[model samples]
Target chain A: MWQPSIAPDAVDRIACVGAGVIGGGWVAHFLARGHRVTAWDPAPDAEDRLRRLVDAAWPALEALGLADGAARDRLTVVGTLEEAVADAEFVQESAPEDLALKSDLLARVDAAAPAGVVIGSSTSGYRMTDMQRAAAHPERLVVGHPFNPPYLVPLVEVAGGESTHPAAVAWAEEFYTLAGKTVIVLDREVPGFIANRLQEALWREALHMLAAGEATVAQIETAVTAGPGLRWPFHGPCSTFHLAGGEGGMAHALDHFGLENPWSRLAGPALTGDLRDTLVTGAAQVTAGRSTTDLIAERDRRLIAVLRALREAQA
Target chain B: MWQPSIAPDAVDRIACVGAGVIGGGWVAHFLARGHRVTAWDPAPDAEDRLRRLVDAAWPALEALGLADGAARDRLTVVGTLEEAVADAEFVQESAPEDLALKSDLLARVDAAAPAGVVIGSSTSGYRMTDMQRAAAHPERLVVGHPFNPPYLVPLVEVAGGESTHPAAVAWAEEFYTLAGKTVIVLDREVPGFIANRLQEALWREALHMLAAGEATVAQIETAVTAGPGLRWPFHGPCSTFHLAGGEGGMAHALDHFGLENPWSRLAGPALTGDLRDTLVTGAAQVTAGRSTTDLIAERDRRLIAVLRALREAQA
Candidate 1:
C-alpha cells in the first residue's frame, strides 16, 4: 500500500483526463496556479478545443492574479491517458457522465498512474463510492466536484467513497485549499452533493413555474437575479434566515418559521428536537463568535459592496 | 368603480401599513424614491423601530443615489390604518402573514383610501385572490410582494386575484418600475409567487441535507457564496443552464441534462413538447438579441467585475 509522501500543497505535476469543458477548466486553473499540467482526452479535436478554452479563460485568471511561473506553455496535451498520468503526482478525471465508461476509465487510470497518487473524479451527480467500485486502489479515489468555470469559482466539494481511506479525503481537501480553492469536505457521499442539490431544487421549481404558466422566463429570471440572488453571494439560505430571526438567530428562525410551509413542492425535514438541535448547534459553530447584531451588520456591509459592484459591472 | 388616473410613475403620496421588517423596508424604499409616505402600525414601539430601520438603510440608499427631493423627513407616522391611507394615492400593506389580519386590514384600507387608489400587499405567501375577498374595492387590490430589505433588493412580484383588475396589476408593475424596482408581473397568482417558491425549494433541500448529516452548515454556506451563488446574480437558473448547453442553448441543455436527474429532493415537471417549447422560447426571449457566444462573453465580463468587487469589499 502506498502512503502520501509529497506535501499536499506542493504537488507540481498534475494530470487531467477527459479534456472537455470541465477538464479544460481544470487545466486553466492549474496553469494559472503555476503548476505543470499533463492533459489527455479522446475527442478528435480535444487539443485545439482545450487550448481555446484555456486562452478564453486566461484573461479572467490574470485579473484574479496568477502565481509565479504561471504560463500557458506549462500545459502538455498528450495523445494517450497512460502517458498523461505516467509522471503525474495528482490526477483529476472530468469524463462524460456515463457510469460504465467512468468505471472502466477510472480503473484504467488507477492501473496506469503512480501507486498511491490520489485521483479525484469531477462527476457532478455520481457518488465516488459507486465510481470507485472497479478501481484497484480505491483507497485513494475521492470525489472533488467543482462548479462550472472551475478556473473562477472557488468551491470544490471533496468527499471519499465507502472504499476510500479517511486520510485520502483529508489529503484532497488540503491539496485543493493549497491550489487557491475553497474546499468543503463532506461527511459522506450524497447525490449531487450540496451546491448542485440546492441548485437543482431551485432549477426544478423554476421549470415547474414555467410549465404551470404562473411566470414567464424573464419574470423568473428577474425574480432571482434582482432579489435573493443579490444577497446570496455574502450569505447562504441558512445564514440569511438566521439573520431574519432578529436577535435569536437560527433557533429563533426555526421556531418562528417552522420547517413546514406550503410554499414549496419539496418537503422539508421534520423539525424534530434532534434535527433542531443539530441545526442550532451547527449554526452556532458557523457564526464563529459573532453576535447576531455583528453578523447582520457584516451582512449589510457586504451586501452594499456587492450591490455597488453589480452596478459598476453593469455600467 | 375606481380607475387609475394618475400617471403610475409620478404617484407622490403612498401609504404603508404594518411596520416590521418588510413594512419598514417599504417605508425606507418609498422615502428614498422621494415619495411622501404615511405609515401606520399597531405595535407599541413601531415608530422607534421604523425610524431606526430607515436610518440604517439611508447610507446604502445614498450610495445608490437617491431620487430628487428625497428626504427621511417626508415620512409621517399615523395613529390608525384608516388615517394612513385616507389621502394616499397608492397603498402598500405589509401586515403580519395571518390570513384574517391581512383580509381585515385590506378591507379597512380599501374602505379608507381615496377612490381610484391601488392597494398592494407585501405578503410573501397567501394569494391576492384569497385576501381580496374582504376588500370593498377588490378590483383595485393587487399583490406587489417585495423581498426582504425591500430598499436594497430591487425585485417586486406583482400578480392579481380573480377580483383584481388587470389594469391595477399593470399599474402596480409600472409604479414599481418607476420607483426603481425590477418588476416581474405574473400571468397568474401561484402560492408564494416566483422567487420565494424558488428560495423555499433551495432552503428546504438545505434543511434536508442538514437533517440527514450529508453536509454541515458551514459547507452549505460556502457551497453557495463561493460556488453557484456567484453566478446567480447575473444569470438565473434557466439562463445559466442554457449557457451550459454550449452552442445549443436551453433546448440542448434540456435534451442533455433531462429533468429526471436524481440530484434534487423535488420532482421536476415532465418535459412535454409544450413545456419544452415554453422553456426554449422563454430562454430565447430573455436572451433577447444576443447569441450564446455573446451571452457567455457578457457573463464572464460581469463575473470578473463582480469577483474583483467582492474581493475589494472584503479588503
Candidate 2:
C-alpha cells in the first residue's frame, strides 16, 4: 500500500513553463481539471498564442465535461520562468527539445520552486536521466511526457531520472492520475517511451510503402483508421493477440505464428526527397483544402464523440 | 467508370466455408446484411459452435441496426462445401491458416462454384498467389482479408495474386464496399498485407518488452488502448504525426524529428518461455477471472458502440 505523501492541495496550483502548443496544451488540461495555472514563455507573442490555443481547445474539453468551477479565467499568463514557478506546488516544463536549454530551465525552476515540489518535463524524446543532469534537486524531477492536444488525449508518460527519488516519481504519477490523465510510469527509461516507439515504427513502415509506391498516403491512412486502429483503443497488441489466439489464447497465438513475425527484418525506410514531398503533398490532399483551424475543430469533435462512445460502451 | 458488373440480387446470396469464429462471423455479418447465408465445415461440432458464435454476436450487430429482413433464421448450415457454394454468387473462405488446407479447399471451391464469381480468402498471413495457385480459375481468386470477428471490424484488405484478374479484384473491392466495408485494394501483394504487418511489428515489440521484463502484459495493453489507441480509430499513424507537428503539419513534423525516430533500432526481441508465460498470466490477471465468453461479449458490445460512434461522427 504505497501512497504519495504530498498534500492534495499541492496539485491545485500548476505552473506551465514554455508556452508553445505542448505547453499551452498542458495549461488547457490543468485548467480544465480545475487547477489554477501560471504559464510563462520567452516568445514575444507566446501569451497571445497560448490564449488562442486554449480558447480553441476549451470547447472540446468542456464537451467532455470539465471539472466543477473550471474556467479559462483560472489561467494567468506570467512574464518570466521564475515568476511563473515561484509559488508552484508542481512545475511542468514543456520547453523546446534542446538538452542544454532544458537543463538550464529545469535547474532554474528547481531553484525557485518550494522544496520537495516535483517538476515534470513534457519531453517526448529525452530521458529524465539526460535532462535532469543540471538540476540542483534532480531527485524531485520527473518526465511527464504528454501527447499532442493533451486535453483531448489522456496519456501522460511519467518516468524519473537515474537520480530521481522514487517518491517524487510516485508523487508525479499520482498527480497525473488525479489530473485525469492515463499514467504509464516506466520503471526505467526506454527510448521513445511506449506509444511514440510503436507509432514511429508504423510510420517508418508507411514511409517504406510510400517510397516503393506500394500504397498512397491516403491508402496508408485508410489501412489504419479503418482496420486495426478500430480495435486498438480497446485492446493493445498483446491482449489483442491473446484474443486472436482463438480459444487457445496468447500462448497459442505466439506458438502458431508469433515466432514467425518478421520484426527483425522490419526497419525504417530511408526518408528520401521524393518520399518527403509525397508525404507533404499527400497530407495536404487528405485535408481537402481544409484550414488547420477547421481540421482541429473537426478532430476535436470526433474525439469528443469517441470519448463519449467509449464511456457509454463501458457503462 | 469501374463497376463490379454484379446485380444487387447477385450479392444477396453468400456462401461461407470454414465454420470457425472468423467463418461464423462472416455468416453473421452476411445474415445481418439481409443476405441468405449457407455455411459448411468439416468439423463434427462446427455447426453447433458456429451457431453459438452467431448467437453471441447477433445482439451486438442488432444494436448496430441490422439490415432490412435480417434475422438469425436466414443462416443455414450445410454438410458439404460444394452444396454451400452451389448457388452462392459470392463465396468467402475463412478456413484455418494452413497453406495446404486453404489451397486444396479453395481449388475445390473454384471447381464447383460458378465461373467469374469471386471467391475471397480470409487468411491473415498467406498471400493470394500461394492460396490460388491450385485453383483452376485463379483469375477469380482474390484475398478479401478481414480482421477478427469479420462482422464488426470494417476494414477488408482486398488484394489479388499474380494470376488473379484485375477485374475480379475490382469486383471484390466494389462488392465489399457495397457490403458496407472500408476497402483498400492493393496494386501489389504485401507480406501480411497492410494492417497485420503493422500489428505484428507492434506485437513483436511487446514480446520483446515482456521477454526483457520491461513491463507486464497489462502495462503493454494499457500503454496502447489508453494512449495512442485513442486517436487511431480516426487517424492513422501518419495523420496522427501530422497533427503532432502542431502548426507545421506533416512537413514540420518530418523536418523536426521524424528522421530521429528510433524505428531502425526496434527489432523484436526473441520470444522465450518466460515471456510467453508472462503474457498468458498477465492477460488472465487483466481479465480478473472473467471467462473468454465474458471477454468476447464485452468486446462485441464495445465494438458495436464504436461502430455506432464512427457512423454518427461521419454523419
Q: State which candidate has the highest lDDT.
A: 1
Clashes in model 1: which pairs?
Answer: none
DockQ of each: 0.79, 0.23
- Interface RMSD of every candidate? 1.2, 12.9
The CAPRI-style docking tier of model 1 reads medium
Reference-based TM-score of each model: 0.97, 0.83
Q: After superposition, how far is residue B90 of candidate 1 from its true place, in Å?
A: 1.2
lDDT of 1 at A140: 89
Which candidate number maximizes DockQ? 1
* Cα shift from native, residue A9, model 1 (Å): 2.2
Q: Candidate 2, which segments miss by more than 4 Å at Cα?
A: A1-9, A261-315, B1-9, B261-264, B267-315
Please provide, for model 1 over B1-315, each residue's C-alpha lDDT reduced to its tens digit, 9 standing for 90 to 100.
Answer: 558967797699999999888899999999999999999999999999899889888887897889999999999999999999999989999998888989999999999988789999998978999999988889999999998789888899999999998889989999999898899888877888899999999999998998888888889989999999998888999899888887788998889889776899899988899989988998998899578667866787777777887787778
What local lDDT does model 2 show for residue A67? 93
Off by over 4 Å in 1: none
